[model samples]
Target: MGDELRADQFRTEAASPRGFRQVYVREGVGGVPLLLVHGWPETKRIWWRNIAPLAAAGFEVIAPDLRGFGDSDVGPDGFHDVPSHARDLYALVRGHLGHERVVAVGGDLGGPVIQDLSLRFPGFVERMVLFNSPLPYDRERMAGLRTRPPREASDYFVPQGTDADALAAELATPEMRRRYIATFYTSRFWAHPGAFAPEEVDFMTEPFGDGAKLRASFGAYESTFSEAARSEPTAMACPNPTPTLVLFGPSDHVIYPDFDRMAAAVFPEHTGPFRLRDCGHFVQWEAAHALNSAVTAWCGDLLAGRRRQ
Candidate 1:
């Protein structure tokens, strides 16, 4: 991860038809551009380990601070739903990067964002990759959650989704907020225990040091409960046609078990729900070398015109 990363900023409109200011880092200037989207409890910097290798392998690696995370501006009046992020990404790739197509990859919240991108900009995506995320599963499976992990596993979701004002007040300062976000990197509920080194912890915590930004990350969960984000993907007239690749961490406690079924249902022609042994929800961080290798290889296959459109 030693390449000199370059930064670029685009107006919110440029990120999506209705998205906000996004700051992205790039590591190469040629080859098929790869758009990497980050997820919750972290920033684009989460890819710090994978980007250099992916770029050096000959792809333009572009990772952006998702709306309401990192230095990117919060979304429309704090509406940081998956649809909004997807739309912004569409704009970023089309209007800002001046490319009509890209090879897309995402994890965690990014999975949903990429799903929405496939929905909104159907022909623009050339290939897709996902990990540590969810597909649009049946409502019954969501109800099945009650039969799964102790509900306490999702206790954090309630406050972040509903009582955000109170949570923000509780984490009043940047340092205090960083400590709260740090829980994810160290908690069995999110990351594998002791997954981050002290320095890595600091790097992950630095962006949340902005109290306003920390508060903003909560809205994505909130959007799920809000009327804006509740529609089922089954309602789509068709499934996304883009060839897809999926990777997962076997030990994840956050994403419910049986996600592979949903992944298969959504992406019928997908590659793997390949498990990352001894890892958790943050597979990208925990399994960088394998992740980078798989993604680089997948991108290579895409560039070689081997994958379906």
Candidate 2:
């Protein structure tokens, strides 16, 4: 929506350990706490459309801007990665919510962070809902998936280069800005072109209008992905056979092709997979009602011991 349209009201809170800044939006007065994590180049505001509905249905919701995103303080290193993001989320849960266990719902980059969090702190994660993120990249599969060769480090950080100033200027133009967002969302909304309202595009692009800000943000993604690729996978076991739900948009250009195989490999014994038709990467935004309904119903079933096998 427009800059003035406050999708959800948020309160700033101090994160423990390092006293890092965090923005949290909470709704509903009872029921289990649910944390919503957004993905790359996005902020907690992305979950705006879903918060009220869930809250109205008697669920408590908490969404935060991951480090270096939105108003949250960039981490001590001014970079973002899966481990650090997972830790930040942990701090938010344990320190702020004072909860030993809670459910986590994540999309895109957030998906991997949630996976890592559940792995690192097995006792803390109660349930997990992962969308459009593959399991940890496996070496054998990486070779088969490599349709394109890796670029040099310099090329890889194009958003961090000095030319980023010029790139931002070009992206500022209405036409280019629309194209940029459409490149990611259009494929998901192919069957429903009107799915992503114009305001949504504005909401997604407004934060990146500043060249330096955009560069720093993208730089973090580039750096983080590099580190996650090398970091050893956490060996912790699944937390209490927690009920897990996996969702995928069949048309998602980045994830659909590999999700089934990855899920079969990583969470072989537990979990149910739901694939949305004619939708792409941004499943929540593109199909909020359908997504929320499915997730809420699944949570209800799990709580009542009626979850599908």
Candidate 3:
């Protein structure tokens, strides 16, 4: 896999006003600077498949490994909450990119982070694109986790005996792993039977092999949401005028089935919604071509207008 494509890394120090440590990524080139933030249990590597294509289409892309995930230094107290995460994002963009205004593209946990980033740092963000994220939705109404109690892990792979161990174990097993993979590809992932090349599956599974790492990643998810919900409302009081686009699989099981409604309520004025037929939560991975095309076209329109202005 290392021979297939080379990934370059850039390191920079970004601190939230609270003195919390934050690290982010900067990659790709062209068009407006676009920051791509990955969700829980995933690293900046999640953007591997999309970066080159987007860069080729003339868009500068940056996919950052949020705090407590990947190689970034973990915060002492762990700034896993939403506002802190968003603030970390704000610092990263402001301190590293040096662009007063840019676009943010996020999915899953990155979705809400970007949403808060847009609201909190409105002037710095010119536009937003959210993929299969649960933003501005009632926590109690979330579809998949509605009945389940909030997970207690601080990161993606919690230890087996720990509260989040079961989830970690499930993701590690063959059958549950297949189902988890299906959550991304939906019916199509199974169409080819051998569709998930062993190498591809290995790449996905490699990160979670270590129980400690897995637990930390799982814990990040649990910690971020609870923090976000508590602080997001106060931070998101003002309506965001930045033009935003939302794309999702209507049949997604991870996000609420009624996500469209949530998207509407989140960005009342500047939101455009697109539903991918038969797609699931991992739209970017499962439907890369479609997702890339949609984003490229939308970004093209925005960039062209910026030039015209």
TM-score of each: 0.85, 0.76, 0.72
Ranking the candidates on TM-score from highest down gives 1, 2, 3
The lowest-lDDT stretch of 10 consecutive residues in candidate 1 is: 4-13
Which segments of candidate 1 are over 4 A away from where they belong?
Answer: 1-19, 139-150, 228-239, 304-309
Task: Give lDDT: candidate 2, residue 289.
Answer: 81
lDDT of 2 by residue, 56-122 (tens): 6556777887766766666665556677778888888777677777778888778878887887887
**Candidate 3, 109: how far from true, in Å?**
0.3
Q: Write the per-residue lDDT of candidate 3 for residues 17-129, one digit (tens) a residue.
A: 43544554555544567888887546676677777687677677777667666555454554355666687777766775566777888887787778778878757777888
Provide the overall lDDT of each model, using Cα atoms, as 2-decimal numbers: 0.73, 0.63, 0.60
Which is the winner by TM-score between candidate 1 and candidate 2?
A: 1
On lDDT, the candidate that comes out on top is: 1
Candidate 2: residue pairs that collide: 188-280
Model 3 sits at a Cα RMSD from the real structure of 6.2
Candidate number that wins on lDDT, 1 or 2: 1
Model 3: lDDT to the true structure: 0.60
